[model samples]
Target: MEAKGDGSAEADKADFQKMIQGMLEKAKQLKPEELVFRYKGVLYPSVPSSVQTLQALGNFQARPEDLVISSYPKCGFNWVNLLLRDIAFINQNESEDGKPGVRSQLKLLEFENAGNYEEMKNDPSPRIYGMHGHYNNLPSSIHQKKTKILVVFRNPKDNAVSYYHFCQNNPLLPTFSSWDEFFRNYMTGEVCWGSYFDHALVWEKHFDDENVKIVTYEELKENLAKGVQSIAEFFGLSLSEEQIQKIAGRGTFQAMSDNAEKTHSSFGKVIFRKGVVGDWKTLFTKEQSEEMDAKFEACLAGTKIGAMLKYDLYCKE
Candidate 1:
């Protein structure tokens, strides 16, 4: 029996090595010659393992009660994620100190830790996972089970501006020489994670699906109380005004950043840069703003999602 167990262990080791080799090959295929990697139209950081994570997600199983906080990169994922956690355990008043809120409570499908896959597979009910993948690329089981998907979108213009700074600040990505170069790539969906509009549109297609709710970052920014209420409602959680206030207050960019010691994973300040609404004004030129406006109108026209968001790019004066 011991010999049989040894043989099984060896087989498992071999399988793991084979999986690593496969990931290496996938990395080569997906890694871009430019700043970041792009695989099947999805932009990933320069990290080869992230590419593998995305590939692995193709086969991930999802339960019906699972809550997935998904967005194209830089679309308030961390913010929404924390809000969900607060709502989930508001009464518990769980402090995320050594407890590590997000890592301990939530699952990230594209998490760098491969062990998370097995851990999540074994985790208990009502699993909540976060991801930064295009809507179409979501795990087949999520669609099959009609898992509850909470998607967040920022105005494409704001998203672009935020993304520019993120790519610049994130050491994992290749930094651009100028905002102009980044803008060009972003407009064309050539940057990591591809076009903002494309990502939004894909999720927009599923707006009518019972299991999906698409919320705008602008909406969250506009009224955190209302945002929290809506999120709670979607998850069938009834929140008192007080509970709503707690969740909203805790989930704010300022609050998250201030408590980075407890809130952030290893990457602290990088995750919480300039989480404001109209900061785009400082960055975009008049011509660039006009161009972005025209593009937003052209691409988002006649879509319910576009109508819902009103497609405005400027931070309101």
Candidate 2:
């Protein structure tokens, strides 16, 4: 049994190395801008995602029972995705087969191939799709069906810092020479998925909509158990207190980080790095901090979503 396990581990390691090599080769073929394709004024990474997929997003059909997780990049997307999957799995009474099935099973609507949209259209009820796009760009059917949409956002300062590190590590994204340069691009909506503020403001308009639930990353971090319970309730799933506690404990940064290899494969480390609040303080200069603050004031201040972020508590030093 030990020998078989060792052999399987070695094969997994080899497969991960090959995947990285393929990404590096693909990166070599394209300029930084070519790494992403622009559609409807939003930049999407072109690696696993295609322009054709984005174009077909509008016509895609959505069922009323469908659930959508929408967020800009690096905004606790993985964390929420995992938690929801666990909730769904437990609700269904599915047994864990000891495989990293949850991450592998989830699909990003924007990143899927255009041809796959047809497959998704025919998929059965209780479907969940993840996406990063402007609120207006989602399938019109979603609105018509009143599909539940969970909009997860983070404070901009920490979001920017996390995004910078993510871009540096992921070959699918363009790298910057310095944080200052990246900060400038980030402020101007030059990064993948466009300006964070633009995305937030649009989603904020729908906060009162019955189908839309606004969740902030900081709130999840501060009280994950409570957050998980709220999310379960939003999804109309009833869970015992014990189940909620277990999900919360497993969903912490350290627990998820430790299990990333199994859940996320080689990309796990890159995706799960330092899931902490206020890391921006280590990297942001006084001026950069002020600039982000001013942008927040101009765009999100006094908005319902802005209050949800608790900006003074999380972003301010």
TM-scores vs. true structure, each candidate: 0.82, 0.90
- Error of model 1, residue 9, in angstroms: 33
The model with the greatest lDDT is: 2
For each candidate in the order shown, give its overall lDDT on alpha carbons: 0.71, 0.82
lDDT by residue for model 1 (75-125), tens: 898778877877876634445451213321324576544555656778666
List candidate 1 segments past 4 Å from native: 1-35, 48-50, 91-106, 112-115, 313-317
- Candidate 2, which segments miss by more than 4 Å at Cα? 1-24, 94-103
Residue 295 of model 2, lDDT score: 96
Residue 50 in model 2: shift from native, Å?
Answer: 2.4
Candidates' RMSD to native: 7.7, 4.5
For 48-94, candidate 2 gives per-residue lDDT tens digits of: 67777777777888888887899999998888988888877677674
| Cα shift from native, residue 81, model 2 (Å) | 0.5
